[model samples]
Target: MSRARRLTASTTAYILIPILAAVSPLLVLPAITANHGASAWASVAIGQSIGTALATVVELGWGLNGPQRVARTSEKASLRWLTLSLQTKVIALIPASAVAAVAAAFLAPSDSLTSSLVACAMTASALTATWFFLGKGTPWLILATDGLPRLVCLALSAIFLVMGAPLMTYPVLGLLLPSALAPCLALYIAAKRAPLGTKLWWRARAVISALKLQSTALFARAASAVYIALPITLVSIASPSSVAAFAAGERLMRMGLAAVAVVPNAMQAWVGAPADRQSKWSRAKRAMAANAALGFISATIFGLAAPWAVTWVFSGVVTLDPISVWLFALAIFTICTSRGTGGIGLVALTRVRAIAVSAAAGACVGIPAILLGSAWGGVPGAVAGEILAELTVLSVQVVAIRRRLAAS
Candidate 1:
C-alpha cells in the first residue's frame, strides 16, 4: 500500500476497533444488572476498577521509564528495552490470572460461578499489554494487536448473549478473552516478521541511575495520572452512579473531541520534529483556537441532547434528573477543551514539568469539589464538583501554555 493509504487505514482501524470492542460491553450492562442484581454488578464494577487502578500504576511506571530509555539509548537499544519489558509483563500475567481466578471464586458470589470468567478477564489484560508493546516498534502492528481483540470480543459477547447466558459471564468473556488472545496473536505475527534476539540487559544500577537523571520525566508521569485518572476515581468514590453517568457523557464527548484532535495531534508531531520555536508556537495557538471553537459547538449540542441521549441509552436502568444531566453536559465541554489544549501544548513544547503542574492542579481542584459536592448536593453536588475541578485544571493549562510559548 502507498504510505498515505497505509496511514489512513491505520487511523481508521484504530478508531473503529475500539468502538466495536466497546459496544458489546457497553450494551451488556443492562443484562448483567438484570441477571446479577445491582449489588452484584457493583461488586464486578469495583473489581474491574481495582484491576484498572493497578494497571494504571504499572503503566505510569513504564511510561516514566520508557521515554527516558529512548533518550539515553539508540533506537535499536530502545526497541530492545521495550521488547524485554513486554516479555516480562507477559510472563507475569500467568500468575496474575491464576490469582484473580482464585479471588473471584472466593470474593464473587458463589452462585455466579465467576472463577473461569475472571481468569479470562485477567488473561485479556495481559494480552493487551503484549499487543501494546508490539505496536511500539511497528506502528502497523497496532491494527493487528490492538484492533483484533475488539473484533474478537464483539463476536464472542454476541454469541454468548444470544445463547441466554448470565449477564455476569459476558464481562469475563468480553474483557478477558480478547485481552488474552490479542497479545498471543500479535506475538505470533511478530515472530513471523522478525524473530526475537537476545540483547544485553541494562543492569539495574544503570537503569536506576538513568531514572534518577531523568526525574522530571518521572514527575510528568505522576502528573499525567492526576490529569487523566483522578476524575474517574473521584467520581467512583463520591457518587458511584455518577461515574456511569459521567462515563456516558464523556464517551460521547470524546468522539466529538477526536474529530477536533486530528489537526492538533498532527501539528504537535510536526512541531516536535523541528527546532523552530516560532513555528511551534504559531501551530500551538492555531490548534488551541480550533479546539476552543470545537468545544463550544460540541458542548452546545450536548447540552441540548444530553437528556434524551442519557434516557435512551440507559433506559429502564438509571434515570437522570435535569441538574445531573446539565452538570454532565457541562463537564463534557470543559474536559474536552482543557485536555485538548493541555495535550497539544505539552507535546509541542516537550514541557513535561508544565504538564505535571497543570494536571496536579486539576486533580487538586476536582477531587475536593467531588467530595464536598457529594456531601452537600448529592448527585448534583458531584456533578458540580467535577465541573469546578475541570475548569480549574483548564485555567492552569492555559496559563502554563501561554508562559511556555512566551519563553519559547
Candidate 2:
C-alpha cells in the first residue's frame, strides 16, 4: 500500500475505535438515566473522571513518551521497554486503583457500587495496548488487542443492563475486562515479534527505578489532570445535577475529540520517526495544521449541537446550560490545537520538561478558575475555567514549538 493510503487507514481505525468505545456507553446510559435519573449518571461520570485521572498515575508517563520511543526503537528494544513499563505500571496500578476507589467513594458516596466499579474499570484503562500499537504503526493490533475487547464488553453491558443484570456488571464487562486483557495480549504479540528479547523483562527493583525515571512525565500528566480529567469529579462534589450536565457535555466533547485525536494518534509516530531535523519538523507542521483545522470544525459543530444532544443522549437525566456548552465547545478547539502544537510537537522533540511546565502553568490557572467559577456561576463558570486552562496550555505549547521546532 502507498504510504498516504496506509496513514489514512491507520487514522480511520484509530478514530473509529474510540468513537465506538465512547458510544457504547449510550446503550446503558439512557436506560440508567430513565430508570434512576441523574444520580447514577453523576456517579458514573465521577468514576470515569477519577479513573481517567488516576490512569495517568498508573500509566507512569508511558502515555506521554511511549509511542515516540517505540517509533524510533528496534523490536527487541521496544519489547524490553514494554516489559519494563508493564512491571512499573503493575506496581503503580495497585495504589492507583486504591486511590481511585477511595476517590470514587468520596465523590459519589451515594452510589458506592457504581462509582467504585466504574472508577476501577476506568483506572484499569492504563493498561491499554493502543499506544504500543500506535507506535508500531499497526492499527490492526490496536483493533484486536484493545478495541475489540472493549467493544465486546461494552456491547454486552448494554445487553446485560436490559436483561436486569446487576448494575456493577456494566463496568465489569464494558471496561475492566478489556483493560486487563489488552496489555497481556500486547505482551504476547511483542514477545512473538521479538522472541530473542523474551527473557529481558524487568523485575522488582527495576520497577522502582522505572518509577523514579517516570516522575517527569508523571508531573506533566498530573498537571493536565487538573483541567482535563478532574472537572467532572469536581462538579460532582459541588452539585449533583451539575456533574451530570457537565459530564454529558464533556462526554460529547470527548467523542468529538476522538475524531480529532486521530491526527496525533497517527502522526505521533510519523513526526517522531527516525529522520533528520528538517524532515521531523516538516511532518510536525503538517500534523499541526491538520489538528488545528479538525479542532476548529469540531468545536463549531459541538457548540451548536451540544445543548440539544445532551438531552437526547441522556433521556433528559441532565441538561447543560448554553454557556457551559459553548465553553466546552471552545475547549475542544484549544485542546486539539494544544495536542498538535504541544503534545505532538513536544513529545516528538523530547521536550518533556516544556510539556510539564506548560501543564503546570495551566493547572495553576485552572484550579482556582474552576473553584471560583463553580462558586460564582456554577457549571458554566467551571467550563469557562477549563477553557482558560486549555488556552493557557495552547499558548505555552505554541510558544515552545516556535522556539524549538522553528529553530530545528
Model 1: per-residue lDDT, tens digit, 1-408?
899887786566545543444354455555554554545454454444334433433333344334323333444555455555455555445555555455444444333345345433633363353323322333345546655655566567646765677655566666766665665665455444443563435455655554454466535544544434344445556666555555444444444454444443333333343447667657766777776766777677777776776555444454567777667667767865765576555655666667667666767776688777865776678778767877887887778777876775
Clashing pairs in 1: 120-176, 121-176, 124-179, 124-180
Please report how far candidate 1 places residue 110 from its true position, in Å.
Answer: 12
Candidate 1's TM-score:
0.72
- Superposed on all Cα atoms, the candidates' RMSDs to the truth, in angstroms, are 5.3, 2.1
List TM-scores for all candidates, in order.
0.72, 0.94
lDDT of 2 by residue, 98-165 (tens): 89988898888467878898999898898876777788888778888887777788888877777777
Q: Which ten residues in a row have the lowest lDDT in candidate 2?
A: 195-204
lDDT score, residue 7, model 1? 74
- Scanning candidate 1 in windows of ten residues, the lowest lDDT window is 130-139
